[model samples]
Target chain A: MPENTQEGFIDQQKVLDNEEYSIKNTQSIIQKAVDWFRARSMFVLAYGTGCGAIEMPPIFTSRYDIERLGVVGVATPRQADILIVSGYCSYKTLKRVIRSYEQMNEPKYVIGLGSCTINGGMYWDSYNTIKKLDEYLPVDMYINGCMPRPEALIEGFVKLQDNIRNAKSEAGYIQYRENNAFYRANQEKIFGKNTTPTFEENFAGMNQ
Target chain B: MFNFAMTPLGNLFFGLTLIVFASLLLIKNERRDLPLHILLFASLGVIFYASDLITLFVGWEIMSWSSYFIIAKSARIETLQKYIIFNLAAGFALLGAIVLIVAFAGTTLYGEIDFGKVPEALRVPITLLLFVTIAIKSGIMPFHYWVVDTYEESDHIFSAILSAIISKAGIFLFIVIFSQIIGYRYLHGSLFDILAWLGVITSIVATFKAISQEELKRLLAYSSIAQIGYIVTVLALLEGSGIEAGLYHTIIHTLVKLLLFVNIASIIYITGKTKFSQLGNLLYDYPALFILLLIGIIALAGMPPLGGFNSKFLIYTTLLEKKKALLLVAVMFSSASAFLYCYKLIYGIYLGQASGDKEGYRELPMSFYIPQFIAAIILVLLGILPSLGIALFNPILGSLGFEVSSYSSLFELHTAFASFNGGVLMGLFGLVFALILLLVTSMRSKAVKVRDRYDISYCGETPDPQNNLHYGYGMGQELRRISFIRVILENSTATYWEHISKLSGDSSVMVKKLYSLGTQYIGLFILLFFTILLFLGVR
Candidate 1:
């Protein structure tokens, strides 16, 4: 989807302008490689709604230490790797929740928490509750509880760690390249065909 | 400690920049429709909490103007003008109050403010000015005209932030002013009494209009107003334990309202359906969202064991313990009246037979559902565990010079007697029964029917399902019949200021006309004006 930046546009322009693209080319390639490597530090956008969000502070703080785990909380989905749907979702919250999830990067993981994540838990029937968290998204891990304490939440962190390691080891970069159809289908089901495209950034003029 | 002096709202400001970046890239595409307003909201939480009043002021103005821009995006120019006018009025009031406080106490620092140290004469005016600013921001009664107009006009995502955080920040500021800074104990109870009455009036009136409205978003707007009234009334009460209960209501209300508003947006997004009259058979098309919205509506309506009931119950018990009998009646009336609006919201959108082919609408993506899913899960979990709401309120209450009550998160709310066990027990039992049914249905029914047609058999009369099952059909009509109470409350709360604005406008015009009576008398009028001005100035 990205426009051919290096060889096609830059090289062609150099030939037309009779300027050398070779002088700074190697330095640029090294910098690009460095950026790609550093950007690999995955940030998770923890959209913690309920009691499970209570567990996040401990996980991120000095206790369990999510930062040591190389997982820090980011503000928006675009900057995140994991989307933690901590607990209970109402129809009211679900709308924004869906928007946040869609906002995340291509390689994303969704973790459903508390008993509400698996089923409605105690509020299975008083209405205004979702029965299963997976029904809405392709959840990687689902933690069970009426309210999961901090200890169990750390356990979820460990499990997610293991899953990431395993997927990376077996699949290589190929799995990363694999189109996320499950995530795609979830998006299609929720947003429908008339997706308001994200073309707001009008970077109309750029020499590069 | 995060250095308040250095990075006051540092986390929030960076977040705001990201959203602005996203909005700038706000190509008219629907896929990336998050406006800059959404990002700016993250800024508000940090700004209001800063220890320095100067830092607080910056965040305050940014929040005001950013929100103003959002309103301007959707509302007519005139409405946007009114919105900004009201906000500017509050801003000027805030500036005047701060200047007076600085003059009297010789400090603009938040930590240095000591109400006891301030001279008595300056105290009342300062307190009055601060309270007016708080009232305007929180949309309490007469100063609240901006909220309804803004909510009705805003994009749903922006409205959700406005309802959840904007007013909350105002109430938060008021708590900071009254409890920590001003400490006006003698006047506290009477002030709350008036606010509680205003909340009752708004709830009774808004709930009535909420019931009658055919447009779904307007009903949600009314619901936001009524919910905020309860929040403001609780803030006015300012009790130690009630702070937790009040904030618990805020937490649950935010989660619950976000759930409802998002679901409302989903309906709008899916079918482009705005009114209840234009919508039907959604369950047949978008089943997942249908079921999700159904649960959200129920919990919001205060069904037991869901998140809404926990806080609503706590609010009731708090009133009862205070043994404010009249307050209890008002609480019950507002709580009960909510059902009318909530019922109409859900049934109007999702219930009844399908309008046509079941395949017309597709389910929304995980991106959108994630937001609702997170909020919904929290609502019910907290509802069953009302004590969780209190525990969360502990740190917030402690900052305001209050001790955190040891309320039970499970069945006991801090104090044993003050807690609620009824909703918890009932909710647990319901979950068990539903699971039992799910197992049985799966056991007996291996192969389920996959028929897609939602239409009825041709054995019948004119079979327009949507026409027959339109919103405003049964319950909506019945609610209208009992709507006289709403009509009364709408006319009931006309304040003294409404008449004042009218009176001043007319008086000023007459004075202007009298001064311009005739060109011939202009010289004499000028001479007389100078003579009178000199006499008054000399005295």
Candidate 2:
């Protein structure tokens, strides 16, 4: 890769390193205990924006029984802790996906599912689909495949749980909150100024 | 001759009327019928204070006619017709009973007239007549045909009056006539039992009907019927405690209905919408009204830590003391199912997604909040001091010749079976609620208010303004899936009344045939009628 393209990759590594350092330095016994509890319970709101939704039933049901790993599905974004943005994100679908992601309570995480969500997979060159999901929404983990199996999905969940428990990676929610302008700018490039409601002050006339 | 006295029972009802009327007047907007409102108030005073049947009948007639005119201002022609017919029938029944009393006992005075002086043959007819009058007024089953329409069609403020004050007149009549004048000895135990069953059945059926209502006022109208049914059941026991229970329920229901109706009236005033489907997501827009409504419904549902629970507690204890197990069970069933409608009421107007545009809604005037605030404060106070109402009722009970219930303190609501501490219950609940609120607010994870109302998770599909997101109309629709509820919802008293009307129409048509006959036939029929009358008179 040329030096210019590698600069973006290098910057991401630096952000991850800073996150790890901060986690090690600030985590007290109570903080670690809190993180452990948070990791033990996860309420997932599976968006299933595209083809990847078919794999979720087996993981939730008796076949995979993902509940054994302390992961469960919730009905609304308000109660959810993790939002799985599964498969391709068309311009229209991305608007709702952004909306659902914003609705989740804080300390939230987003998991990008399938190669479609990673880089649009087979639809990478399509005008309607976005190539990179992370530019619009901060993706904590990306399970890249045309269609990830139930086993791969569960493995992704376990790894995400480990990352949460150990504070091994930068949380997408925190990055989204801190660098909201960057994400908002990218989203606005496609949806214009009215892109999935602004995070800035006085938005919707809400004081807080 | 007319006689009027402020007896304790009368005083209690008069006080309730004053409170309800005062609150209603505060929020009333239509100023055109002020005189008529005064007439209605004055009539209630007459009915309550009258010591003689003649005076009471005059007051009752004035009340009926004045209310009829008031209803006529806003109601449809059919509604007006139904109102007049029902009130006329009620008036005739009262008149019939009074005429019998005056003829047989030679006096209509409450203290002077003796039921024993009346012939045994006439006593049953008098009791039945009085019962018909009371049953129709109180919206008891079968005779309750006219209530729902009248309540729904009346002016909103007048509807509050109808539910809160006017309906209680029947209850007052019951206490005065059956318990005091005729005396319980003249009434059969089986008759009271039947009455109690009728009350419970009315409550159960009306509750199911309330759940299926689409309009806000219609639901409330049904709810008023159901709540009154409870009072009727408890009062039918004819015990001192039962009367006490009924009175307590009466007071709580008055306050709750006033609060709810006023809150809803304000919403209607601001939004110009009456159907639940048209109103939603108003909690943020009108927090005060929402909280008042919450208090109202919480009490209306007979939940703990509210005035409604205190009354329900007293009623249940009274039933348990009487060992009316089946009636108690039925009452409990109705009370439990009430939670569903209560939830629906709240969810429909406040908690769900907004169903319509919000740009047009304006803030209600300060006058609208006055009644709601007063009612809410009183409800909370009653929850803290359960025996406050009992203490008030004690004098009335004694005056009515029933033994007064004893209570050690205002906070403690004592009964034969059990007693609960209202202060402690309220304090405990307040503490828990406060703690939970504090914890949620101070939590590390903050609530992110969505920027737009349409920003809800819809399986990755954006909800459009045209989409019906509110659960208001659909909340209780699924209750029909249950076989028993299906049966209840499917059958309506309106259908039965319609059938009766059709039957009466057929009978009238057959009678009309006689008028169509030739002059010679008419003359022969008149002669036959005179001959039959002479034969009966001679016998």
Candidate 3:
């Protein structure tokens, strides 16, 4: 009790215990209801960074008809719930991805599409392309394939939806918020100090 | 002798002038035009208070000439030519009408002269001349050729005066000469019908023209023409209720224009950019100005819970009471189409993304806000107490010998066809707005401010600073795709005027050729003219 009351002192054991307890018991009935609704209606802002963009059209259109599951495509990042980073993210592409990811409202998710986004695929040897997308952005799920098929992308979305509905894993946006420094350090390594949208400026008044 | 008396009508107009001129005084400018502005203000007073035709004409001339000089300070040679020509024509028409009135009534004084004594045949010409003068001054279409260019070219601060006060002077003249003095009973019904249609058409065309404009002032210039068009239409109805509605709209429009113009003037003062394409994403930087402009546009659009809606409600109800279905439809159509330009005005300047470097922009002077705040407050007050304007109009209507509209309270605008409670409407809107605001702000999801203006998502590629992202100039370009709009946009009054000028030029050249054919042909022509005159004299 004295340790808990001490200024500038954190009880690691108590904190871990509290974290486990909160994760298991703190989610109220209201939070579960909210998560249920959030999972049902998903607005995806599919940022076409590489070749994986071609698979999205068939799925969104009459062929695959992804809207049957309450998923829809929106125009702007502000309206989106999920951001799809499709295929390889080059150094230049990564900057915009980071900017767009930062702009979206919280409770947002990110799906890394294709092996290119995971390990750069064929562009792994290229100095320009980022090999691992998660190093820069908190990717919630990755569909693995050189160029992921439409079915694989659909599977990845289904898995993500299930995780979201059950609160099975922490959201990517929360992780991005908590561990922003590590991501920013990785970004600044390539873009230098002059990188646009520095963390300090973007998240200035935002609550931790 | 120049005679002046302050009647309720005169007081109403004088009150409007004082409000406009007082607000304009707050604006600081480099141009030493205060004396000219004062002269213009004095002339408006003379016109409003004058009880005699000679005094009225003198005031009218002074008003035109003073504004002419003010406009001339910044206008180009062609604009000056157009201004003087249109105004001179308007002046001549007024002079002709005054001469006719004096000759027919045998007295220049308004009270002494009985319009009933005037010959029936002569009344048509007098009214026609008065209509021409009013049309030119008030910018009724075809005669409206001078309005946009003159407004666009004038000093920004003076444009407020031009739209808010000078144009209303024409409305005053109509109410005085046509409604009160000549009396609508003496006029032909066909003339009022034609005038109503003309006003509605002018508003519709002007609204579309406003939308297609890229420049801010030019858009505002067309919008001014459009708003005045509504007042002119309702006044043409000539009923007591119609005139009441017209007066209410006049007051609302004056406040709205003052607020909007001063707001835009501050934007121009700070950024030195007048075109929509050059302005964007200024919402955060100048939040107060944005809110003021938002109020202005909302009022301008005539939505509920604003002074604009009360006037529009009155106008529609009056039209319904008169059973003017087609005319009301046209008016409503024009009013509906005005939303596009209203949205463009706010969105172009305040919303979207910043068009240029944020470092270059500076804060507007505190003095610039005085007029806007005054106008905005009055607009809100008028919205809360919609019939407050009607209460003010009662004495003026009584003085004009029209039955004054009755109201139970300041909040209730009672009409023959319909009535509404302003307080209830405003309260509901405020409550809903507050609830929605609370709901949005208190949401669990956090709203992240974008890192920068260029932080918008553009697929995967970063937007270059050089790339233009603002939809200000391009917002209305798509309207041209619609067939009816295309028809209206493609046809211009300028072309019609150009054709007339060309026709006159060709006819003059033919006369010049005939004169150059020889002195013999000139002598023969003069002989023929004199012979016709001598024959008429002999008869």
Q: Which candidate is the best by TM-score?
A: 2
Docking quality (DockQ) of candidate 2: 0.31
Error of 1 at B413 (Å): 2.1
Looking at model 3 chain B, report the run of 10 residues with the lowest lDDT sum.
B453-462
Winner on TM-score between 1 and 2 is 2
Clash number by candidate, in order: 60, 0, 0
Docking class of 3: acceptable
The best candidate by DockQ is: 3
Rank order by DockQ, top first?
3, 2, 1
Model 1 spans with C-alpha error above 4 angstroms? A1-208, B1-35, B119-125, B184-188, B354-363, B408-411, B421-427, B430-432, B435-462, B473-475, B489-526, B530-539
Segments of candidate 2 deviating more than 4 angstroms? A1-30, A46-69, A83-96, A112-133, A142-162, A178-195, A198-208, B359-363, B506-513, B526-539
DockQ of each: 0.01, 0.31, 0.31
Interface RMSD (Å) of model 2? 4.0
Per-model lDDT: 0.63, 0.88, 0.88
When just chain B is superposed on the true chain B, each candidate scores a TM-score of 0.82, 0.96, 0.96
Per-residue accuracy of model 2 over B372-433 as CA lDDT, tens digit each: 78889999999999999999999988988889889999999998899999999999999999
What TM-score is obtained by chain A of candidate 1? 0.62
lDDT of 2 at B404: 88
**Worst 10-residue stretch by lDDT in candidate 3 chain A?**
A17-26
